[model samples]
Target: MAIDITLIHWIYISFILAVIGFMLFRRDTTIVCVVGILTLAATSTLSVSASITSLFNSFIFAITELLPTILVISIIVAMSKILTKSGINEVMVAPFSKIIKTPTTAFWTIGLLMMVISFFFWPSPAVALIGAVLLPVALRAGLPALGIAVAMNLFGHGIALSGDYIIQAAPKITADAAGIPVLDVVNASIPLVITMGLVTTITAYIILMRDLKKNKTYTSTSTCSSSPIEETQEGLMSERMKKILAISIPIIFVLDVVVMFTLNLQGGDATALIGGTALLILVVTTCFAHKKRGLEETTGYLIEGFQFGFKVFGPVIPIAAFFYLGDAGFYSIVGDYLPENSEGIVNDLGVALANGVPLTKEVGVITLTGVGVITGLDGSGFSGISLAGSIAQLFSTAIGASTATLTALGQVTAIWVGGGTLVPWALIPAAAICGVDPFELARKNLLPVSIGLVITTIVAMFLV
Candidate 1:
């Protein structure tokens, strides 16, 4: 009845702690992750050459496993580039812009639009997508740049990314580690995300309103002396064509969703459908926008997108590879070295804890939330959540709790903390776009986000 905990298990856990410590200290974990893999490999194979080969193989495996996520992100970025260049983004947001008459309207309008766009294009690009065009208008309408930054950060990077329902990247990673279906995590996260989003955004808006009432002279940050908007350049596409693409593009993506539901597609199949749609959009948009040199321009846009994708994902891969060793990567990257009757290293640990300790759902909920916040200190939100997922699986099994709820809790906490709201560095894109100091944005977000996390964690206890 006892599960055997192997040396590999200890190594995996030890390296995980080291990775967390590094993240807490705000150090890069790539080296720590690589060394962890090599140590696991060397322990398993006991041969220097094979161990090194295993290390290389582990990287290959990580890349292979993450390729679909990478591909979809790259393709989406490619599509966004074409959309931005062709001025179609302006067309897309025109109707929404007309409704922003005051600071209240500005906050809700920009925040909601950012959340929607972020679901599809992701927050980093979505910040650029809506920020530049709307920043000056919001500033003129009396919303401070800091308020704008907070809205985008909380709505787009915090709310949209935490749920990640459309793209499913966050859910996919956490679900993989929790050893559950992606839909399970997504389904469980809906309520928690809504709660966190509502609590955080409303709290921030109220605090911001009070701050404004007290300091009616409160104005945009110093950097807002000039607009972030670029001068409009004449493009290859006509205004009529831009407007057409703007209307048609959303319809195409909407149809992708309809088709997904109709065909019962999910997971990788769903992601593939979305990726294919983005790729087609990129090609067609580039072709229409570039006209004669459409072929070359399309390639050029894709290359840029790939570059951005890899740059963003590069730090994530090594860390992800290390966590993969806890479960699926154990046999392939190391060896069939798990003890007999052992489910996996992480699972074994969970079993051992369950047998030895009196764990409860409350303990599990708090632990996952704590781990999520600690891991999020690194500011690269995605880099640390693999650890969250692994830990969620470990804790949930021990507590006899729902892995999906625990995993979703961890996923949301990590993203809210590091995905651009609480972390200064992660908040830079939105901050810079709105001409506010990143630290100020993070400061403004601290209270609201902390409160949200507390409430969300309490809600998660019941869910678990």
Candidate 2:
């Protein structure tokens, strides 16, 4: 059957094209989302009166859903700010500096710390913490600021945030679309993630090596100007603050890890656990910051936290709203759709391709991987995983490829692109925190990431 594109399809395609056009010409996430939403409304025949309303409603809904998580992240960030002001953040990483003497070790240490913290806390918060503390160490150890940016970008945001095994954001999207268990998707994502990490990290190491050699031959060093490091004044509970933070942060986080293992709360539950712990830490930190005015201070910190959250996620809201429209669950929010249609443009596309394209298991896996990488060009890794999961569904048939392999490949490619490597915009947090150029970071990651992606694809062919 010839694929019949409907009004919904046209709306979606127009939105995507508008985003693409904006990216090419504008490169602003906010503008791209606004243009995309407007185009979608126009294509859907929404009334002028309803267009803005729909957009606002959609935006509000998306934000509300994400607000709790963002709030938790904000609290953590606020606590990190408090920690920074107290000079404890610097103190925390002081030990690591002594242990990691060389530039290479410093780079990897920061990268590894980023990866670990990001896996539990997330990339944004991890970036702030690591950048505030460890970045100086790396730079002082002779690592280029750009190099630190790349390491954090790849290991933390790109790999850890993209996979999000502990957080479950990525898996939840994929699992819901595929109608499979989240744990299954998590399991499937592991080998592909490991392979991609090895490929990308090794390639990144080689690039770092070359850069190091170049630095060796040059006496002129482009020293990064010192980033403003804020130190909070000691509150009434200064002594207690020191003890609590030193003991509390690690203890709670460690408990979270232990709980995750004991209960097998692998995905969303794990994220919730970590977020919950961060909230507790936030309250404790604020209490220390204010003492008698703890309540007021906590509120103040919460507001600051929300402001930071909004700053980081405000641009993402509309973008996610536009992408949310592509999902069946939110298609109605975008506009009324034709009857008999399920949600998401990518899912529809996947179904059409699955039914029409005749292929073997290997080809099916490769095709799914390509679909993931293509959809990921939008630079929101989670946006495309639904399509990946839909593709995974096709390959899960009796005669199809292994669903696990298909899912893993889809995750690896989607994340690699949207998480950091290909898109300059996606590297904003790490790049900004490191005080480096986002475009340069993206460019540096390209070759290493591409080689890793290819190697991962080949590895998936055999393993999956």
Candidate 3:
């Protein structure tokens, strides 16, 4: 069960630390990540020319692994776009708006509704779906735009994305790296996700209510985005048509969820089912909305969706490429350079260190939470989670801990911090959609998010 530590292992560890260092300062990690890959390749093949070849090969591997996730997100975004253009998005949330009569109701109603929509649409598009229609209704209820932004950011990105029960995008990446079942990660995440979601959203609501009572309206006027989503044009489709599609789309997605449960589809299979359904909805909705120009409009929507997907994932791919070297990817990228006794560099290190160091459960929990928060500093919220899963595997193997619990803890912390609640730049989508300052929204979320993370980390410690 014991294996020797090699030079390649040291290289992987050092570069991981370097990547974390870069992220902590809010700097990009792409260059550090690539350099790490090239170094690993160079050491493995012992040939500069071969090392260079392996660098590109690593990216190809990453893209191939990530393409399905990108496609599903792109297709869903395209579907949301068509819904917005046809004014169906408005129709979807209209029923909920009737129940919102006060600031407290506005906050909870929007936050909870955002959590649900985000489960289906992902948060970026969910922000678009909820904010445009529900924001005005929330604002009219006496909540400031900043409060509205916080609700959407926390509930959508913080809660929904951390769990990712529908898309399974976040869990898929993490579980794959941990070498465990995707449902293992998903099932383990349920409690941690609930704790984080309830703690953060409730704390945020109480504090926001206090602030709103002190100041009835916001004073800041600074905006980051050149355009806000509140400026979307009037409905393109007829009112009857918009209403029909609005009813039909949610039913289709609901049925997809039912199918997912019935078939026991958790990872890529579930995602494909949703993606294919979204594509059909997008095509059908575009035809009705654009009439004579439906064909051209559908292409344009697909192009925009793909652009959005790539732009969001551009920073992710390089970091993912670097982390993949920790396990199976090392053999693929670095060739046959690992020691004969090694299971994988990380697993080998775990066994060696476990014998020598004996990491306790408390230490394991804290380290994972720290790694999650630090990796999230790059602001993508997702770019470094492969590292989290790999680290979880190491610590779990070392300390005889629960890999699923540790992975879930890291996943929750990462999303709550960088999934738009604590990071200013990451807050842009929610901020722009709600017409508030991103930094202001981040500031508002700081205390509640920090408190929630601490509680969740402690809870994870006990779980492990």
Write one digit per residue (lDDT tens) for candidate 2, span 1-464: 23455776666666676665655443655666676666666556557766677688778766765665565556565666666666555556566678677877977888888899788766765665566557656776888777888898899867897678777888888888788888888888788898888788878878888878876432211111223334546544456557656655666666776776678664345556666766677677667666788788777767765666556555556766776566542455655554455435655655565566567776777677677766675566777787788778767774456776687678778888876666655665665555454555666788888888788778887876
TM-score rank order: 2, 3, 1
What's every prediction's RMSD, in angstroms?
7.7, 5.8, 6.9
lDDT of 3 by residue, 326-432 (tens): 65677787777898876566555544544454478898888788777766654657766776788789889988999999998888887777677876556666765
What is the lDDT for 1 in model 3? 46
TM-score for candidate 3? 0.66
Candidate 1 runs further than 4 Å off: 99-232, 359-464
lDDT of model 2 at residue 292?
Answer: 80
